[model samples]
Target chain A: MLIGACLFAAGLYMVLTKSNAIQVLIGIEFIINAGVINLVAFGKYDRYHNSGQIFALFAIVLAAAATAVALAIILNVYRRFKTIDPGKIDELKD
Target chain B: MEQGIFIFLGLTTVASAWFVAASQNLVRSVFMFFVTLFAVAGLYVFALADFVAVTQIVIYVGGVLVLMLFTFMLSSKETLEKLEESRHPVFTLKQFPALLVAAAFLIVLVNAIFKLKPDQLGWILQATNNTFRPQDNTVTNIGTNLMTTFLLPFEAISILLMMALIGAAHLARKERSFD
Candidate 1:
């Protein structure tokens, strides 16, 4: 649990500090892994159902799918804007 | 021995995660993220989630990290050069606000963790007393449950994955406007 919390904090920091969109995705992955750790830790006690592990598996797949879509979007954004920096991609704002 | 290994794995996970967050080089940060993921898989093993650990390696390490690397490579070279040239020290005054927010969140979560005491929950206590025999083979139970109780979700996730695949390919293809 403590480990999960620490990872969450680190991920949040990563998300906030990094300007790169892909780095932000990496941060999001860290946050998801943190949640998975907590779930698996609690699932250890639930020996029969073991739903936590199952949920973690689902979460992993979802995260992977999300990453795929997100990276694709990032690639498209780079092609259009010529930059992957989240701060610089402000064509939508103006 | 088990406790020691658990502690070691936990440290490995957190430290590598910290490196992933702190590293300035994008490529180096991604590699550190890989270490963090593997350490997390080790932590999953300590939790007796062998299946999850395997899935973590196969999906996260094999699929996602490789995809991230490919995207990194495919990004505009000028952007990579700009990012590489704009390096700052690990700790800077500009990042103080982010550090503060992350620390505040950690403090709140740690307080909640100690206060909640999940181990003392009624369901956990009952489950531990009645059918809590630790078994070596969780894969069989997982497969049975997936086929029986979780069949709907299993099918739904497959459909979701397929949609994501098609969507990604469509979104990532060279724009017709550019041709």
Candidate 2:
């Protein structure tokens, strides 16, 4: 659990600090991976119910689908702006 | 033996995670991300969640990471070079505060987990009324549950996937001039 928490925190820090859009995506993956670790850790002890495992499965699917959509959006952003820098693409700033 | 395996998985996960963060090359980072995912999937298997472990590998490493790589290839010819340039402004700012906050959070979380009683942890494994019967096969059980109990959500997800496919195609299509 300590390891899980540490991994989650480190991932979150990278997500928050990274300037590259791809790095940000990696950070998101790390965070999700941390959550999966926690789910599996908890599931280890549960004898009768595999709810944690089921939840983890759903999470994995959701993460995959979400990443697919997100990558599409990132591609779109690159097409319009000619660059993938999140900071420079400030066309929608209020 | 189990502890040794756990340590190996843990080291692999942490090292790959660090590589994912530190690598300036986008493609390399993505590859390292794949490594991290694979390691975590190994951990899931060690935890006795065979179904989840398999799903993690299939969905994340096979499906999602490949999609990411495709996007990287399609979106930019400079994907390799751009990573060398620190154009993203987020990293330019001093990150000490962020590091401090993360460290603080880690300390608290570690303390809390250590304080938890062994019995409390054991309770997580206890069978409940809603537990799936051992007689049923896992894949079949999951399939039945999705079709019967979670039918609506499953249908909704299909609709969502369809919409996503349409949206992606629409977005990616080159604009045509009517003139």
In order, candidate lDDTs are 0.89, 0.71
Clashing pairs in 1: none
lDDT tens readout by residue for model 1, A1-94: 9999999999999999898999999999989988999998888876666688888999999999999999999998888888888988877732
Superposing every Cα of model 2 onto the true structure, what RMSD results?
3.8
Best by DockQ: 1
Error of 2 at B18 (Å): 1.9
True contacts kept of 2: 0.50
Interface RMSD of 2: 3.2
TM-score, every prediction: 0.95, 0.83
Report the poorest 10 consecutive residues by lDDT, candidate 1 chain B.
Answer: B127-136
**Lowest summed lDDT window (length 10), candidate 2 chain A:** A43-52
